[model samples]
Target: MKIVLPTAGKGTRLRPHTHTKAKSLVHVAGKTVLEHIVSRLASLDADEYIFINDDENGPQVMAFMAEKFPQLNCWATVQQERLGPAHAVSLAAPRINKGDDVLVVFNDTIFVTDLDRIPQLCADCDGLIYSKEVEDYQRFGVNVVDDQGLIVDMVEKPDTPVSRLAQVGLYYLKDGRGFMDFLEKTIQAGETVKGEYYLPAVFMNMIRAGLKLKAPTIDAWLDCGKPETLLETNRYLLRDRHHVHGEATDTVLIEPVHIEKGAVVRNAILGPNVSVAAGSVITESIVRDSIINADSEVRAMILDGSIIGDSARLVGSARRMNIGDHSLVEMT
Candidate 1:
């Protein structure tokens, strides 16, 4: 089985953090997003690994793979153009064979599913596409299935209430070469939306050709696209509350908080959806619903709904937070 991960998008929503590193390298819940994703899929034991990275992030990804997944046969390649998803996947055609089982997953969103069972589950089908039932269907590309639960069509941000099974970016093709040929034809046909070809078009064309593309359901879809979702994923991951490093020194730690090794917290209240990464210090501050990245210092400030980047120094005085009765003073 060949596993492909496309990390080409330079997470502009993540700002200063992504400016220096790839979006997948962004730290969350004591690990990089890429690390969490790779670790989760480690059990699959894929035969080959293909990482689609941007030009600037290729070295970083390769370095990460060398350290984390050194035993696996991995190759890092760059997506020379930002045309679309189909174009990005096409870059791996050189490494793909006709009958190889290809599994393409986007790195921004991680889904919870038993990937080990996929081979047996899709043995009778030509391909599989994982989707989740979402209420906000218009915000994503949804898959339309027939009575047999096979994908018949797909609509990107539909005008009406088409389908709630939002495609969460996990695709498996039993015939990898057929998928690549469809992608090439998609590019040649000039079938594009917003000036770029999309993966839905390729899959739809494959379905039209009598391919049984089954739409399977996933357990959970955790999106790490932007800051809000990154923090949200942090909270979701920290649900395993055993992450606290010894007893807090002069600090009160709330549950569901992850304090990594080497993070010092003193005279502060932290928790209930917070993660203090390694090498960070927090003193005389109340941090909640936020992620304090590595090598950062937080002193004497009330931080909530915030994300402190790596090596950032944040200092503020809380003495002026005192306000009289009946006055609601909220920091924006």
Candidate 2:
């Protein structure tokens, strides 16, 4: 089995923080989104992990991977053109072999599912497309399935409520070469949704060819693509945490907080959903529903729904922020 992660999006939604590092590198719950995804997929013990990234930061991403997860056989490929999901994943076709199990995951969201079930789930089907039931079906592409849980069709933000199973951009295919073949056909045929070619078209081609895909629902789908969702995801992941690493002198503690052992916290009120990464310092501030990345400094400030990037400094203010790495803010 192999894992293919299409991570070429320039996360404009996350802005300032994304301005410095890749969106997947932004910290949340004391780990990068990419780290969390890799951790989640560690259960598969895949033969290799392939990342298709934009040309500019491909080396940086590979460097980070080598430094953080040297145990995994990881390869990074450049998606020189911002074409589409199918095109981005096509970069990994050279590594994926015929009949190999391949999991294609988009890196913008975190999903809770049992990766161990891939063998049983794909035993009778060509692949599996995961989804979560959502009330707001109009906002997402959804899978239309039969009573047997076989996906018959997929619709992208339909005007009518055809299905409630919103696609989460996770798929496991038993035929790795077959998947790439369909992707190639779609690209050569210019089958596109908007101006860009997407994966659903490839899936449609597969379905039209009598390929069967099962629609499995996941327990949780946490989106980390933007600040609001990132804070919400932080809150979700930190719900069970209520501890501080060092002594908090003259400070109040709130439930669901994760202050790292290397971080410094004093004279502040922290919590009900906050995570301060290692080497960061917080003093005389109230931080709630926020994630402060590594080596950052916050002093005499109040924050909520904020994301502080690595090595950032904030002083003399009380507001929500999306500060990037190496940023400095001092209010008069």
Candidate 3:
């Protein structure tokens, strides 16, 4: 099966970090968001990997893929216009064969599931959409299933939700050509929410044409779109994967903290939930529930719920901050 990753979004919510690197490249729990997603799908034997990316960070993403996953067949295209998710997926059509099965996933969302089961679930259907039961269904697009347990329609952020199955950003289509046709038709129809075509709209169109879409449940759907969600994902990953390989002197070590190799810590109280990247230094400080990127330094300070970017320096006093890469901030 071919894999399609739509990673072209501007990621305006992620701000300064996104300014320097793609949102997928943001580090959390000792690895980039894209790395986390790729690691989870490493077991799946994908025929090709197609990435839809923006002009600014597209090259960087391709380079990262080349260095990390050189053995895989990877292709990337620049999405010149910020059309939307459906439009992004359409960019990969030229490279895909008509009869090929496609696995479409968004780059910013990480899901923990048995990806091998997706093809089996799509055996008797035109497509399979992964979903998780969410209490806040109004915040996301959802699948409206019929009495027969098949997806009848998809509603995006409904004012009054009819179902709790929130559509996670994972899709498996048995027929790539059929999906491309529906996507093109959806774009031609000019049917959009907020002037952008959504992938769910394409699925809805297919359902109207009598195509079967099966809904599969996932174990966990972790979103990294915003600051809070990113931190939550970091905490979730570090709970079991956290490790420390750095030097610490006169510091209080907390469980579930990941201090990467080359990091130096001294006279600090660090984490119930924290990740200190390689080459970073923390001295005479207290930190918790945050991510300190590579080569950054925190001195004589107390930080919580913060995201310090690469090569940043934070010193003096106690406070929470979101410092970007190569930045210097002193709290008086």
Candidate 4:
């Protein structure tokens, strides 16, 4: 099977951070979001890896993957117009095997599932979707499933939802060409709203064509789309670590803290749910429930539930701001 990772979104909700870097390249806990997803995909028997990214970030992505996951046969397609999810997938159809299964994964999602169980599940269905029950369905693409776990209906961000089984952006296509044909039909029928064609419409088309669609419940799934979501995901990852960091320090930690390698923390109360990425310095600061990205310096500041991006400098200042990657802020 081939893996297609769509990372072209500008992530407007993430603001200044997305303005500077691609959403998939956002750093959390010493690794980029794309790196985390690629590492997970490496566990599978993937024959080819296709990356769909925007023109602005294509070069950076190439250099990044070249150094990180060079073992895999990788190729990239540029989405020059920033059309939509369906259009992005259509750009890579020529590279994928027509009759083989293709796995479409969103770059912002951190997927954790039994990779070996996917092939068998896809054998009996035209398309297989991954779903997770969340507290609220209005914030996501909800799946209306029957008692037998079949995805009978889907509504993307409905005003009034009937179920909380949100689609987690992991899809298995038994035949890549068949799915593309449905997408084409949706376009021809003028079903697009807001000039963007969503992937859910394709599923509706398949249903109209009498194809069976199934939903598999996932064990772990996280969407790192916004800054708040990023911080939440980072905290969830650090929940079970006595000493999450690989590096050592004479400074004391208050438990449930993650200090990455090469991080120096002295006389600081780092705890509860703090993630200090590699090459970051945290000294004399009380940090809790936040993500401090790599190569940044934090000193004498109270960092709580904040995201400090890569190469950022935070000093003894008490002022707090929603900072982006490669920023510098100092206390006067």
Candidate 5:
């Protein structure tokens, strides 16, 4: 089995940070989003990984991967056009073997689960999809399954959905043939909406054609789509702060905070939940429930529920900003 992970999107919503590194490189809980995915997938029977990146930061992603996960055989493919997820998977066709099982995971979704059991679970099934019970299905693709847990239909953001089971960003395919064919047909037939082909349509076609698909609800999942949601995800994952690194001198730290090495803190209150990356300095500051990336500085400020990027300087700044890496701002 292999895993196809797409990290090519422009990530316009996660500005500043995305401006420099791939969105998958965004750090959460002392690890990048893509790193979390690869680590989880590594525990499975996955033979190799296919990482799809864009022209913007493809080399950087490969460099990061080499430094971090040298044991895994990771192959990188460039996507000239930033199409939908289905299209992104199509680019992996040349690398993927026919009739081989492949797991397609979204780069931004930080899933916490026993992934080692997923390949075994899906081996007996034709395809497997993950779902979650959401209050509102209008914003996500909804899956309608039969009593036997076999998905019958999937409606993308249906106004009136039969089930609140929303599609999470995990999919197991027995073969990538149908997925690639679907993308080609959808694009050739000119059935695209808003200039992008959707992956749900492929699943819908497969379901209608009598292909068995299973939907297994996960225990915990986080969508790092927007700034607020990203912050929430970090807080939720920070339940254990033992692994977080930070040097404290007369500093008070609350539970669930990650202070990386080379970060110096003095007389500062850090975290009910927070992540301060390496080389960052925190002095006489109050940081709670936030993510501070590498090489950032915080002094004499109250930072709550914010995402501070690398090399960012915050002094007496209290404004809520989703800043990018290496940005400097001084507050009085």
Candidate 6:
């Protein structure tokens, strides 16, 4: 099987941090978002890994992958234009062989699931889409399944939802060439929503051509596109994998917090959902539900639901903040 990852988005929602690094590189729970996604696929045997990225950060992503996953056959292509997901996947067509099973994942979302079952599920259908039952169906693209449990239609942000099964950012296609063909047709037809071709539109086209796609449920889907979602994802991850390996002298350590090696904490109350990266220092502060990046420092502050970037320094009495890398903010 081959893997296709679309990571070219500018991540305008994740501002200052996205300005310095790719959205996938944002740290949460001691790992990058891309690392979290790749870890989920660790059990699978992939022949090739293709990443569609923006021109600016494409090389950086490739470099990171090469360093971390050198054994895998990884390739990166720059998406010069901010076309769309479908167009991004199309860029990897040259590398994928016909009849090959392909796994497509979006980089901005993190999901926890038993990925080993995907092959078997895809074996039973023409394609598979991982979905979660979400209350806010209007906020996401959803799969309209019939009574038989087969996806009949794909609707993007429907005004009146036909189904509650919102499609997560994961997909599997048993026939790679067939999907490529449909994607090409979708691009050629110029049938775009908001002037951009969507991957679901191609799936809908395939369904119209008699392809059967199945929707499978997952354990959880966490999005990291916006500030609130990113912070929530941080909390979710830290809740599962939290430990203190660094010094915290005279500090009140709350349960479920991660203080990485080389971090120093003193006279602080660190929390139920917090992750302090390596070399960061927290002194005389109260932090909860926050992520303090590497080499950052927080002094005499009460921080909650915050995301401090690498090498940032925050001092004073701010309750919440989103400080970017190498920034200095002194509030009173």
List the RMSD of every prediction in angstroms.
Answer: 1.9, 6.3, 6.0, 6.3, 6.4, 6.0
Tens-digit lDDT track of model 6 for 96-213: 8876888999988999889888768777579889999999899988998987778988888889968889989899999987888899999999978788888888998898889899
User: Weakest 10 consecutive residues, lDDT, candidate 6?
Assistant: 116-125
Best by TM-score: 1
lDDT for each of the candidates? 0.88, 0.88, 0.89, 0.80, 0.81, 0.89
Error of 1 at 221 (Å): 0.7
Residues 239-312, model 3: lDDT tens digits: 77658888888988888998888999999999978999899999999999999999999998878899999999
lDDT of 1 by residue, 1-332 (tens): 88889899888988878998999988888888888888878888788989889899889988988998789899878998788888889888888986788999999987789888888878878999999999999899999998888888899899788799999999999999889899999999998888877899999899889889988989989998889998888888888664787336987878888888888898999988898888999999999999998889999888998999999999996455667899987666
lDDT (Cα, tens digit) per residue for candidate 4, span 1-332: 88888889778887767777888888765578889888887778788888898888877887899999878898998988866888788777777766767889988778778877876877767778888888887889888877866778998887886878888989988888787677777867877769987888888788878888888888888778888888877766666665655554566677677777777787677777777778888877888888777788888888788888778998875555799999998853
Candidate 6 backbone collisions, by pair: none
RMSD of 5: 6.4
Across 62-143, the per-residue lDDT of candidate 2 in tens digits comes to 8888989899998888898788888999889999887687999998998889989888878899999999999999999999
Shift of residue 327 alpha carbon in model 1, Å = 6.8
Pairs of residues clashing in candidate 3: none
Displacement of the residue 51 alpha carbon in candidate 6, Å: 0.6
Model 3 ranges off by over 4 Å: 317-332
What residue pairs clash in candidate 1, if any at all?
A: none
lDDT of 5 by residue, 1-332 (tens): 77888888878888877888888889887778877777777667578789889988888889999999888888989988866777887788777767767789987788776766765767666788888889878998888988988898888888886888888889888766665665577667665657776778777777767678888887777877678878888888887655545688898888877878888888899888788888988898988888889898889889888899988998874467888999998863
Each prediction's number of clashing residue pairs: 0, 0, 0, 0, 3, 0
